[model samples]
Target: MNKLSGHHHISMLTKNGKRNNDFYTKILGLRRVKKTVNQDSPSMYHLFYGDLTGAAGTELTFFEMPVAGRTVRGTNAITRIGLLVPSYASLQYWKERFQQEEVKHSDITTYAGRDALFFEDHEGLRMVLLNHHGHEVPAHWQSWDGNEIPEEHRILGMGTVEITVRYLQRTVNLLKNLFGYTVVTESEKEAVLQSIAGEVFGEIVVKELEGPSEKPGRGSIHHLALRVASVEDLQEWDAKIKEQGFDSTGVVDRYYFQSLYFRDRNGILFEMATDGPGFTVDSAVEDLGKKLDLPPFLEEKRAEIEAILEPLE
Candidate 1:
């Protein structure tokens, strides 16, 4: 069975780019590695934030669409994204930081057998911090305080993604048959699936929605990307996705990575993204988030794009 390794990154729509930037960079301390515009909507900005190199598994991206409606939360969409932190101590530190910064947060809770801290970003997108297991700590995860967090205590990777769906069978079948996910557990309202070996990454939780359809809007997840090792892997998956009667766009070059977008049987947008030419392609590891980068394709139009984008600082 070919299974995805874990989550790559989750993309969301936000109304305020500056506020999002300040929150993720200044407060959360995630590095802002890329400052570009959305290919579908060049007039708006697209931002990427993550660990030092903005590696595949440690990224959170955003599409700045101020006019997009507020996303309705229900079934058939991504509910929240989880980020694996270093340790229980990091969690405690964050709890204090959130309070000191006047950021609203929830008390600790146990989910998926791990302790977690739940919070929202400036734009109201939901997020979770967990003590991840079974992966190497990222080399470039900068600590908030001058104190050092041992390598053994750094984040492992994204642990899981929550998906809401109206009907379980179609989504479940898609996961089992097409995506190579095996049902790990099941209940009346939800089922958990683990990806087949050698796929992208992350566990997927499919939850049954009990209400009406939802409308995608701000503070809502736009799509969740599944990691593909390279362009060839993505092409293979693209063919596989299309063969299953689902339409998939050709590989699109995202400055730091290449990706193909498609939706699952349940209508949640998914991206198979590559891990090459990472965040360091444009900036040094120590100086990521210091500048705005334009992909080669968009270089000629840089002046125009720059004119339209709001300044991050």
Candidate 2:
């Protein structure tokens, strides 16, 4: 059985940190659960948006990397992020809102027997609001602007994501053999794999691509992470990845959660992360995302780090 609960979070690149915050918190009505900096490059911000409590599977994170430029579409990168909604009425509500906000979006379309509203963020990050047909419905968060978005229509959490791979079978094997994902649905061009146990947040639609490899930049996915039970589980998975001849990052402390990163056959980055000592580790839930927080190792440079980061509205 898969030891993972479901999707822990999906991290993507964005050009402007402030705009990214507004798009998610204001427009999408998610809560800004954590405001921190990229561990690898402390100057750039690493922001997280999720439910009121920053629950697993609901978290969507971003790294502000404007210098990376816009993403180049091709094989081996995550394409669309799907957030779950309650019903068809929610889909209808989004269509009208998209039109009013002048956000580019597609009319509701059917996929896997659910209604999906496809759209893009200001930075051209593809996204979807799909009905939670077979997934657990997480609690909706109160928007910072107070009741701007109705509770019913608010997004539940991260639902599904579309990934483009060069060869379908190789990627499929890795998910099935390693992650215990089973083929829930398949078509000529794409296939949907779900965790054998998790009904929500584990949906991964693999689409075959015929083109030059994707060039990473702004709006490109940094990595997609799956939730593990504990640190021991992470170590076990790390060993499994190495046994499969795929290079793994072993284990790294992410402060909130320990992580292990590895790339697939197509070089798309994947991470297995534990869910504990979370955002509340450094700050209280009420004060989350209100101020900048840093890991203990970086505490000495807090003053220097604060100087470089632009103020968020």
Score each candidate by Cα lDDT: 0.75, 0.84
Which residue pairs of candidate 2 clash?
none
Lowest lDDT block of 10, candidate 1: 140-149
lDDT of 2: 0.84
Cα distance off (Å), candidate 2, residue 168? 0.6
Residues 1-313, candidate 1: write the lDDT tens digits: 2345556788889888999888887677676777778877788988988766677777888999878777777778888787777678777877887898888788878665578888887667887877653444434344323123344444444666888888877777887888778788788878888774322136777889878767788888989888777788788888888999998998988868899998877888988888787877877777666676777777898889888888989
Backbone clashes (count) for model 1 = 16
Number of clashing pairs per prediction, in order: 16, 0
Query: lDDT winner among the candidates?
Result: 2
Candidate 1: where are CA atoms >4 Å away?
1-3, 133-157, 196-201
List model 2 lDDT by residue over 238-268, tens digit each.
9989999999999999999999999999888
Q: What is the TM-score of each candidate against the true structure?
A: 0.89, 0.95
Per-residue lDDT value at 173 in model 2: 82
**Highest TM-score among the candidates is held by which one?**
2
